[model samples]
Target chain A: MAKKPRKKAPKPTPKETAAKAKKPKHPDMEIPFLKNVLVLIALFFLTYYLVGNVKGYKWLQERFIEGNLNKLEKFADLTTDQKYQAYFRFNHQFLTFIRDNTADTAIIYMPPDSVLDVEDKKSAFYTKKRSNSVQHKTWSTYHIYPRKLVYDREKEEIPSFDQYTHVACVDGWGYEYLEYDVPKQQRARYQVLPRTVKGLKAMNEREKNQAQ
Target chain B: MTLIHLIVLFLCGFGLMNLISPKFGLLEKIGFSFPLAHGLVTLLMLPYDLLGIPITLTSLYIPQLLVIAFVGGWLFYKQQLPQAVRIQDWNKAKSFGFLSINLPWIFLMSILGYLLYVVIAKAMFWPTISFDSVAGYDFVGKMIAIEGKVNGSMFDPDLPFYSIRSGYPLYVPGGFGYAYLMGFDSSKITTVLLILSTVVMYYALLLNYVKHTMAALFTTLFITTTEYIAMSALSLSNVPHTFLAVAAVVTIFIWMDKRDHRYFWLGVIFMALNVWARSDGIVFIAGTGLSLLLFAYQEKKWKELIIFGAVSGAAFMIWQVYLSGTLGITNDGVFVDHLFWDGEKFDRMTDLIWRVITNTQFYGVAMIVIPIGILANFRTIHKQHYHLLIAILVSWLAYTALYYQMDNGGENFGYSLKSMINSSYKRGMFAIIGVLYFYVGISPMTQKLSQLIIEPGNPFKPKQ
Candidate 1:
């Protein structure tokens, strides 16, 4: 008996053929250039808006910082670069210092005005008190986000500043309800800030001049 | 003599009780060890009441030792006790044993080992006060002991602002509340009873899942290895209830399989015990009852279904009555008083799910085995294991949802989520795990392997 012929697969319909043919050579190109540009703009503005306004992201960042600080071990071995980076990163400079120095005694400078906000409310320093335009000022003042450092463990601590009482500033971010070790002896009773790099530079300069 | 001496004396007393226990019938044998341990510990504390020993390490150690001695003796006696019913050594038990019982045992061992290292060597108990235990089991346990009844206050303090109505007693296998009610100091009894109940719970869980005695023992070993389970057992909260929940699930599933109404009653007893172990148990009771009805439906046993329905209904109604009449609580606040309606509650619940999904460690290491098992028998899933797995997953989902939304308007989602699982979701998922294991252990594939080797060529072979 003759073997039954296998049925040939149906040919593609014109619509299917056209659809397949019409597929973009670079598939992503069909996304309009203008739309792409708009998206980029939107994302930029969106990130800016969210970062500036939403309290949730800020809270998460703070928690992330707290978590990171708690995880840090052996601060004495940090690179000078790492020390500066960490110093610039967290709101809790004192904790960063403790983590770095493993200090037997180290001072944390808390401005008398640095009362911790224990209540689950937005820091007054950020909200309510500031004008919309000026809120960014307060936001910039605190290291509001956690920065994951990729520093060698051995190169974490370096004495960069001559004002080395081996102190770390642990910014409570106004949540004093959270606990960390900060000895009374190590605390700076006064917080002096024009809090700018320039201001710090000026203070260093003044100290140098006085020493001279 | 110091408190240590008193504890040593208590240890001797407990050993004595265990020896005498075997003679006085089953209940007496089962229960006798508890009294000597609890009584001695209670007496040791009396000096604090009478002579006022400083409430320090030595003082706490005294009671802790007394309790441990009792449990140790109980364990010793259990080892000596003959296997309850020597089932003819069907190789079926051996084959299914590893997944059901051995895996839990191994898991428990590794966990306990790590925890010991961390706690003893590193002096680390990070994120202490086990999260889930504080909210559901531990706090409520204290309340039960203090008030001598399950009350609004049992769910209060944990979620003071929220008015929830889902309060049930501890649902863990080694039910803390049951032990507490059986006349152990709520605070002092927790460590001892939890450890003891954990062993019993594991054996029971294994019995339902594994067919072979060795396999059951192996599973118990796995449970002991699990750090989370070990940590949980020691805490005042979730571990005990989680164990109980698993025990209840295993017991009922066994009842279904065995068609033994005695197992059914045992299941009910465990379920009722679970109710007092944790607030989430109320929802569990409802879900479990629904699942049992499905089981009855599958078996075409209307009589069993009706009986189960009535018993489940009576159990729930009793708790409801207690809540409404005795405790003066509303439906929303009987068990856990989490803020359910609030947005924050929803967000936190979502966040918790996200965290669990994201965290690799949260799902125990043995999780890898489960997928492999499923993959190996993917074809059988729809025909055999689907319902069981589905029931367990659904129960977990339901319990999580209840806990996620238990607070007041989700206002305190952080608090609510934390309260529900308390520390971790491990304890909350205990019952579901037990259900999953029963399916895993009793899978046709596993059971068939055993039957093939043990009772080969027997005419009355179970059909696949």
Candidate 2:
């Protein structure tokens, strides 16, 4: 009853060996439901704790959650003009005022940046250092589109400088170009006046007359 | 009515996508429709404005409807109408306990939803106020809408008040014009929709290579890039251009990997639109072109290379012809005619680029995460995605080189080269951020990690 010679197991072919390596270890293994749940919970908590400790997280939370969301909610009830005003402030107001006062086809004479940037306590116009929105030609044109703007610097370049239909008076710069005198009380810091030139006075002439 | 208009636009894009290829997934179809439709609309408006056709909502809508009809008729004739998802499949998916099995998805979805809501609300609640938009794109768009012509008052030489940015391509302005023509009070809706389309398409594209969980996770990461998300709410061309560039490169990469002709054609369309979004988008085109050329050489497919180069370069050529040939506008002299080496300029550009790219405050964990992912999978990197790596590197180098060669001495529109680097260049990195995250998402290491978490004991594999 001696055992017959034991048969050696057949060697795995190359294809079988490769397939075995590729196959999942536990093809029928059930998902470890509790383990996955616990791991996920740990991961969520870890991420929460890690992100909470970062300095950037506070800024993000404040900027996006507290600040932007609240601001958006508040803005929900405002009109489009109010919303524009909130962002553009006085720039929008001035431009809209110009739009209302001038015709669509009117050519406006704008003050030079130098004049607009002058610091006058009694007549505070936009300064380039403080704000460029109103000082920016394209920005102003966008606000009052279909109306053209010309500056003193462009006076030499633009032959139609003398033909400007209106003057955007800022810091009383354009008053000298006006034909009639605006009474002291009537003159405001910012005004869009019709460019009447029946008796335009040069600054030098006014200075000579004052000296006399 | 706005909703109806949006629906029409989406359908128009959906029909176009179906006509291009009926093999797209549901999410892919939904994600790509709005942008394709929007891009086509902007392109259509160009010819209309040039040919003296009044750009009314009717004018745009009728052509789109015809597209839909033609797609439907063609598909019906070919008997290749797209198969709808069956109810039984939905039931099977519903019964799979997806919620319990994929908790990461829930977390990622919540984050993405919150960010999207905030961005959309911010965009909708405010009018266009960004300086560039107000002075340039929005201004031109407003003029176009009011005058019903592209060559209207805004382009008058006598006015001379329009910003240099107004001379850039008409995508953003046309978008604004389209919104206005649709009777919307605010053009910000277009911005909002574009953002939505970008996010959706990004996620859908990721799903092709990764599982749902990984796709959601990386897509969340893509949107959360701080400066990018901040700028997303503003009506700028950068964010939208980012979408086109990323779509083009990624689709081309997918085509390389899958050898699918549909992806190839889609990639070509996006690459063309990339330039239409902004002329500088040619950097992306050049980058992807090199990749395609390499693929063609390796596979001996010269015809595909010819097709891609000719089609992608068409938009750039057309835009140039319009600007210089048709309008007789001289070159702005932004770049030097010949390349020169300035150590100071090179160093300054690279230093700033490094600072911007690595600044965690701007890019969150992406700059850190991407490198770590690459290193972890370095052994298999060459085998899987060397083409994509080359594309990213070449495009980035070309972009930086362009800036280096720019004549930064004179200020244009109050923007010096230094200022442009800090702002425009910083914003332009949004495209790179997107493509990098996408690459990392498809990397083998990420796939393995995803499997370990989602289903332990299962072998790691790509979704395909």
lDDT per residue (tens digit) for residues B1-464 in model 1: 33444345345434544443322223222322333333333333323423535423345445556555665656656774332112222233444422133222343344344433332221121211332333344444444443444443323332221123124432331234334444443332444444444454454444444443323423433343333433542444455555556656665666676666655655665565565445557666666667777777888877866765566556556656655565455554323554436676577767766555333344342354455556667788777646456557667777776655444334333344454453446555545555554565567666654443222244255557
TM-score of each: 0.45, 0.88
Model 1 misplacement above 4 A: A1-212, B1-192, B204-227, B233-236, B331-355, B382-387, B400-426, B444-464
A122 Cα displacement, candidate 2 (Å) = 8.3
What lDDT score is found at residue A123 in candidate 2? 32
Model 2 chain A worst lDDT window (10 residues): A23-32
Give a tens-digit lDDT track for model 2, residues B1-464.
Answer: 98899889888898888877878776777777887898899898779878999877888889998988898788878777634222343454555543235556667778788888888878877888788888777887787777888777666666567666786677778888888888888888888887888888999898888777778779988888877888889999898888889999999899888888888888899899888888999999888889888988899988978888998899888888887765556456777778788887778877878887787777777887899988988999889987898788899888887787777765433456678788889888899889988889999999887677666545545555
- Restricted to chain B, the TM-score per model reads 0.58, 0.95
